[model samples]
Every structure is written in structure tokens, then in C-alpha cells.
Target: MDLLIAWLLTAISLLIIAQLPIGVEIDNFGKALVAAIVFGILNAIVKPVLLVLTIPITILTLGIFLIILNAIIFGLAAALVQGFRLRYGFWSAIFGSVFLSIVNGLLNQVVSR
Candidate 1:
């Protein structure tokens, strides 16, 4: 149940992110949901390895480099998911990931209460 709720919230966040001017585009709700699932899977499977590999940079940047890692994963997700596009390259991915994280955090807070 918790996982389902989280996934739905992520999908909602993706939909909201798509509406932003940052050039993250989702063709429809179905695409947003699919992108959310792919994004979650990528984060779960790939982000840890990336974090480990980028530890030096992450430390040097005082953890700020994690945002860039997140952007990379976001771009990968957009590449893998059909009908979802990061139209502005790395910059789009960066902004999209940041906004997505923010929106997801806010939604999670509301849902948790």
C-alpha cells in the first residue's frame, strides 16, 4: 500500500513537472506514470552505484553533486520511457530533477499527514 501510494505520488509529481517551463515533457498521464516507474527503478538500481562511484566529487561539492547524478538518472529515464522527453539536454534534466524532487517531497509530506 505504501509503495503504491508513493508510486502514485511520483506519477503526480511527474505530471506536475511536465507542466513546468523546464522542457520536461510527458505526452499524457500514462506516459507520466510510466516515466515515474522507470525513474524509480533507475534510482533504486543505478543511483547507489553512481553515488559510490562519484563519492569524491560528491564530498568535494558538499553533497551538491548528488543533484547532477540525479539529473543523469532523470535523463536516462527520459531516454528509456516513451512519450517522455527531456527537451533541453542536461539543463532540462537538472531543472526537471530538482523540481520533481521538490514536488515529490511536498506531496509526500501532505500524504504522510
Candidate 2:
């Protein structure tokens, strides 16, 4: 039940992110849902490994490299989802990832309460 709620919230967050003027675009709610799932998968399975491998760089950048790593995953998700796109390419991915994290955090907080 918690996982399902998280998935739906992530989908909703993606849709909301797309509506913003940040160059993240989703063709429809269905696409948003797909993108959210893909994003979550990558974040779950890939992010940790990447983080461990990039520890040196991450430390050098004082943890800022994690944000770039997130952007890379975001771009990967957009590439995997046909109807989800970043209008401004990598820049859009960066902004989209940041906004997605923010929106998801806020939404999860609301739902948890």
C-alpha cells in the first residue's frame, strides 16, 4: 500500500513538474505515470551504485555531484519514456530533477499526514 501510494504521488509530482515553465514536458498523465515509474526504478537500482562509484568526485564537490547524478538519471528516464521529454535537454533535466524531488517531498509530507 505504501509503495502504491508513493508511485501515485510520484506520478502526480511528474505531472505537476511538467506543467511548470521548467522545460519538462509530458504528453499526458499516462506518460507522467510511466516516467515516474522509470525514474523510480533507476533511482532505486542505479543511483546507489553510481553514488558509490562516484564517491571521490562527490566528496570533491562537497556532495554537489549527487545533484548532477540525479540529472543524469532524470535524462535517462526521459530518454526511456517516449512521451516524456526535456525541452531544453540536459539543463531541463537538471531543473526537472530538482523540481521533481521538491514536489515529491512536499506531496509525500502532505499524504503522510
Candidate 3:
């Protein structure tokens, strides 16, 4: 149940991010959940691989390159979810990714209390 709420909050955050002046829209909550699941799975599975591959770049950029990697992962998750539609451009996805991450972090912190 806690996980469900977290995913719902993530979906809501994603929706808001999409609705921002520079945002996009997720058409269905169910699909958004699926997107979140995909994101988690990918983050656990592929993220480390990507991180390893980008080690030099990440080191060179002083870890700032992780932001771009995160955006790419978020975009991939959005693409995997059919109902979580993102008509916005790359910039919106980047911003939306940041928006949702921050919102999720805040919510997690509060909910864990």
C-alpha cells in the first residue's frame, strides 16, 4: 500500500511536470504506474551499467553528467509507458524529470516519518 501511494504521488508529480509551462501530460494513471515500475527496474538494472559506461564522462564533468543520464532514463521510462504520454520536447522531459525527482524525494521524506 505504501508503494502504491508512492507511485501515485510520482504519477501526480509527473502530471504536474507535464502540465508546467514547459511540461507534458500523462494520459492514464495506470500507465503512469507502469512507467514508474519500469523506471525502478531500469534504475536498478540499467543505471549501473550506464554509470559504469559513463564513468570517465561523469568524472570529467564532476558528476554533473548524471543529470543528463537521469533525464535519459526518465525519458526512456516515459516512452515505455503507453498512457504516460509526453508530447513535450527534450527540454521539458529534462525539467519534468527534475521536477518529479524533487517532488518524489520530498514526499518520500515526509511519508517515511
Local distance difference test, per candidate? Answer: 0.95, 0.94, 0.78
Which of the predicted structures, 1 or 3, would earn the higher TM-score when compared with the native?
1
Error of 1 at 47 (Å): 0.4
Per-residue CA lDDT of model 2 for 1-113, tens digit only, reads 99889999999999999999999999998998898899999999999999999999999999999999999999999999999999999999999999999999999999999
Off by over 4 Å in 1: none
Q: Candidate 2's error at 100, in angstroms?
A: 0.5
Residue 69's C-alpha lDDT in candidate 2?
99
TM-score, model 2 to reference: 0.97
TM-scores of the candidates are 0.97, 0.97, 0.85
Give, for candidate 1, the lowest lDDT window spanning 10 residues: 28-37
- The local lDDT score (0 to 100) that residue 102 gets in candidate 1 is 99
RMSD of 2: 0.7
Per-residue lDDT of 49 in model 1: 96
Question: Candidate 1 lDDT, tens digit per residue, 15-95?
Answer: 999899999999999988899899999999999999999999999999999999999999999999999998899999999
Query: Candidate 2 — which residues are off by over 4 angstroms?
Result: none
Q: Output the lDDT of residue 95, model 1.
A: 100
**Candidates in order: C-alpha RMSD to true structure:** 0.7, 0.7, 1.9
